[model samples]
Each structure stands twice: as structure tokens, then as C-alpha cells.
Target: MSIAAVRIIGIDPGSRHTGYGVIESERGRARMIAAGRISTASGTVPQRLLQIQRELAALLHEFTPAEAAIEEVFVNRNVQTALVLGQARGVALCALAQSGLDVAEYAPTQVKLALTGSGRAEKLQVQHMVKVLLNLQGAMAVDASDALAIALTHAQVRGMKARTDALAGGKRWGRA
Candidate 1:
């Protein structure tokens, strides 16, 4: 028996550039549909947020993904940068919600670990793994690759959950 493919959209939110990737996954196999970045470099904060929203909305409508995933904000020493990132994330969440997508949030470490088996893996390592996993040749934007990683992580997690649920006769221990 063959499992149905689940289409997913992943977002890597940033103030200047928000990356998005779309994929269809069935069982443990994933095929890339599209990947790109929404650039808002020459706009004010509000304008940038608006741009992100509009572009994401368009992408969602175009792909009609059944699920969505986004990278959670990782705060570092720079407070202002984190705040801006949060804003971008908020916009992304809103867009996903409006599109009626079930959004899943994953941390940077989770994404890296899912793709490279090491939470502390470097960006290049993650990118290389993304290319390998999707069987793609040639270069891609770093942000777009990160978004693909996020989608792949969600796909892996969902696959595990589905197997566990099947093994347990579709019983849940607690709230999911």
C-alpha cells in the first residue's frame, strides 16, 4: 500500500528576507516543490512585515499546502535583532493561520539535528544535507535551504508520530 503525500510549506522568517519552501512527503520520502525568498530590504519595518504577509499569502494560495512549519525565534546577544525577528515570525504565523494551515514550530537546533543528526551542525552541513535528501543538484539560497530543512523536520516528526500511533492502536497517552 502506498501512503498519500502531504504537502507542506516551511517558513524561515527574517526581517529582511523570509525564505519559504514547499514539499510533498509520502512515507519517508520528500520531493521539493518550490523554494524562494521574499526580500523586503528597502522597506520600513511595517512595510517589510506587510511584504512578508502578502508574499506568503500568495505562496500559500499557489501551493495550497496542507501543513506549514516555521522556525522559532532564536534569541542571541542582540536584543533588537531578536525583537525584529519576532515581528517577522509573528507575521509569518498570521499568514499561515489565515491560510488555514496547521503550523508547526521548530527550533534551529531541532531543524539542524533533523537534517544532519547533530544539533550543533554548521549551516553548510545543513544545506548540503538538504540538497542530498531532496536529491537536488546545484546551489540554493541559504535561507531557502533552511526553510526546506524545517519542512523536512516536520515530515520526519509526523512520520514517527504516525508510526507510533499505529503501533499503539491509535491511542493517545495525553494531549497531543
Candidate 2:
């Protein structure tokens, strides 16, 4: 069976700098399409949220991703920090939902485990595995690499689900 290629968008939402990555997946393989950071350093919180929305909207228009995967917000020791991060994540989710993409949420540890075989893996390890898995060249920004890892994890997990479903239904799995 052959699977049609699917493009997926991954987001790592941050109040100061959000990372995004687009990837194409077919069967069980995934490749990076584009990855970058959305910097909102020069703006207020509201302004930054607007910036994230606008940029994410543009990416949705350009990539037309079939699905989206986002890193679930983690609780920080600082209440202020957690609140700000949640706000950023909310904006990102809103954009994706408005764009009509099916959004999947994954914990940071889940993403790391999917990529590096350990839930407690460090960011550097996740980044390195993402590079190796997608066959990317040169240096990737840490933020972008993390986003790519999220996308990779989604592709892998979704693909597995598709296969499982197909098997349960007594049919061959193709695209998901």
C-alpha cells in the first residue's frame, strides 16, 4: 500500500519566541519542509500575541497543513511565567483551529521520548535526533529543531494509529 503525502505544522509556543516547523510525511517517513522562529521581542504582550496569530495565519495559508501538532504547556515554578506561556499557547491554538486543521497536543516529555527513546532526554538530544531523522543539514536553531521534533513525533504516532486501525479493520494501511 502507498500513502499519500501529508504536510503537518508543529508549534512550540513561547511568549518571547515561538518556533514553527512544517514537514511532509508519507508512509512512515517524514522530511522537513521549513522551520523558523517567530520573535516578538519588540512588542507588548498583546502585540506579540497578534504577531503570533498573523504569522501563523500566513504559514497556514502557505503550507495548508493537513494537521497541526503543538507542544502542551508545561507548568513553570514562576506563576507569571506560566501565565504568559499559556497566553502564547492559546493564541497559537486559536490560529490553528481557525485554519481548520486537526490539532494534536503532546507533552514536551512525550515529544522527547518519541524522538530520543527517553522521556527525560535533554533538548540537545531531541534536536540532534530531529536532525538525524529528517536528514537536515547545517545548524538548526534550537527552537526550530524542537518544533521539528514535535512534528516528527506527531507523524510517527499518527502513522502508527493509522496502521493499527487498518489492521483492526482487516485492511491495508495507506495514508493518514
Candidate 3:
């Protein structure tokens, strides 16, 4: 018997550059389908958010992913920056919710730990692991690579849950 593939989308939200990646997972394996950034032009906050919604809507329509994983907003010393980041994350969450995708939020530490076995791993380390895991070539933009890392992390975590659920034979956890 063959298991059907599950499509997952991951987003790294930012007011100026929201990165997205799509992947297909099956039987504990995952492969990248597409990855890119949604670059919003300089404008009012509402205007930028609208652009993000439009772009994300189109991607959701195109892939219709089974689930989505996003990086949770990490507050920094800069209050303004943290607020803006939260807003961007809200917009992203709305977009995914509208599509009815099962969304999972992971902290930066969780993502880093999943990818590099260290919660404090550097960006370059995460990027290199993503490239290797997906068997991709050439350089990848940091934001886009981060999105891919989120997707991969989701797949691994969910895949483990699925197996455990199956072994328990009570009820399956993920989407049916």
C-alpha cells in the first residue's frame, strides 16, 4: 500500500519580505515544490498587508496545501519592530486560516533545533541543512530558506505523530 502525499506550506512573515515555501511529504519523506518571497512595496501598513494577502491567496489557491507552518513572532528590544512583526504574522495567519489549512506556529528556537539539533544554531547552519535535506542546488535567499526549514520541521514533527498514532491504533491525528 502507498500513502498519499501531503502538501504543506510554510511562511516566514515580514512586512517587507514574506517568504513562502511549499513541499510534498509522503511516508516520512519530504521534497520541496516551490519557494520564494513576497516583496511588498513601501507603503502604508494596511497597503502592505493587502499585498501580502493577495500574494498569499494566490499561492494558497495554486497549491491548496493540507497544512501550513509559520514562525511565531519573536519580540526583540525594539518595540516598534516587534509590533510590526506581530502585525505581519497576523496577516499571514489570516491568510492561512481563510484557506482552512491546519496551521502550526513554531518558535525560532524550535525551528533551529529541529533543523540543526541546536536551538541556538546560526542562520547559515539552518540554511545549509535545508539545502541538504531538500537536495537543492545553488544559493537560496535567507528568508526563503527559513520558510523551507519551517516546512521541513513541520513534516518531521507531524510524521512522527502520525506514526505514533498508527501504532496506538486509537485515532489518527492529522487530516484524514
Candidate 4:
């Protein structure tokens, strides 16, 4: 018998509405556990960041995930929005660090490509693929789906890395 693998929590950080998702993988399979967004009422930027940090900490404790995958903020057409997203991501990192969980980052293009087989696929297409792959039925908010997609992408990359390392006879991280 083998020990069970742990789950991962994925976060899509936004100052106004930070999205989060939990996923588990074992024997080369990935599944979504939960996904949601946390939004703070109108407040100052620092206050909003603090609220996001507190919420992230609570979520980490509740989920008890082994690791975290966070979507990296890319240069966007909207500078202000990007800045706010950066702040939210910082808060998320802080929470993960406090909990002593490892954090990984992925880009949007990478996430889209991993989930939909095409980086340029439309948002609806990505969402549909997520629902189909996860076997989730009926309506799901786009933000929730996006968060799940991010988690899945990280899972795929991590799986590929494991295979490559095995072929090259490399040791797995954090495994003795």
C-alpha cells in the first residue's frame, strides 16, 4: 500500500474579487474539489488587501492543501486593474508562506493551452473544456471555472515534470 497524495489549492487573485480552487491528483488523475471567489466591500486599497489576506489564510486552513498554484499577473491593457491583481496575489503568497505551503505560479497562456489545447481559445471554449474534463454539469461562473482551469494546468505540468524526472533518474522534491 502507498500513502495518499495531498490536494492543491489554486488562486486567481484580484483585489476586488479573488478566486480560489482546490484540486486533488493521484495516479495521474486530477479532480476539482472546490472553487469560489472572495470579494471585499468598497474600501481603501490596504484594507482590501488585508481582507484578502485574512480570507486566504482562512481558506488555507479550511482546505489544508499540500501546495498552492497562483496565476501570475501579466501586463494587461488596464494598468490599474493589473496593479490591484498584483496586490491580491501578494496577499495570497503571504498566506501561503505563513502556512508553510509551497507555492507555484503559472501564466495565463500556459493555463489556456493546457486546458483547451490552444492558447487562443475563447473564454467560453476554455470554460466548456473545464466542465467537460471535470464532468461538472450545468452552470458554473466563469471565474470559478478559470480558477479550476489554472489548477488543472499546474497539475498537468507537474505530472509531466514528474515523468521527465523519472526518465532522467532524478529524485522527487520533498520525498526522501
The candidate maximizing TM-score is 1
Q: List the residue pairs that clash in candidate 2.
A: none
Worst 10 residues of 4 by lDDT: 1-10
lDDT of 4 by residue, 60-158 (tens): 899898978888897779998888888888888999899998888998888889988888888899899888877888887776788888888877777
Question: What is candidate 3's lDDT per residue for 135-159, written digit by digit as tens?
Answer: 9999888989999999999999988
Report model 1's TM-score to 2 decimal places: 0.97
Pairwise TM-score winner, candidates 2 and 3 = 2
| TM-score to native of every candidate shown | 0.97, 0.95, 0.94, 0.89
Q: How would you encode candidate 1's per-residue C-alpha lDDT over 125-174 as one tens digit per residue?
A: 99999999999999899999999999999999988888776777777545
Runs off by more than 4 Å, candidate 3: 1-3, 172-176
What lDDT does the true structure give each of the candidates? 0.94, 0.92, 0.92, 0.83
Comparison by TM-score, 1 against 4, better one = 1
Worst lDDT window (10 residues) for model 1?
167-176
Clashes of 1: 0
lDDT of 4: 0.83
Rank by TM-score (best first): 1, 2, 3, 4
Q: Could you list the CA RMSD of all candidates, in the order they appear?
A: 1.4, 3.0, 2.5, 2.9
* Top lDDT model: 1
Deviation (Å) of 160 in candidate 1 = 0.3
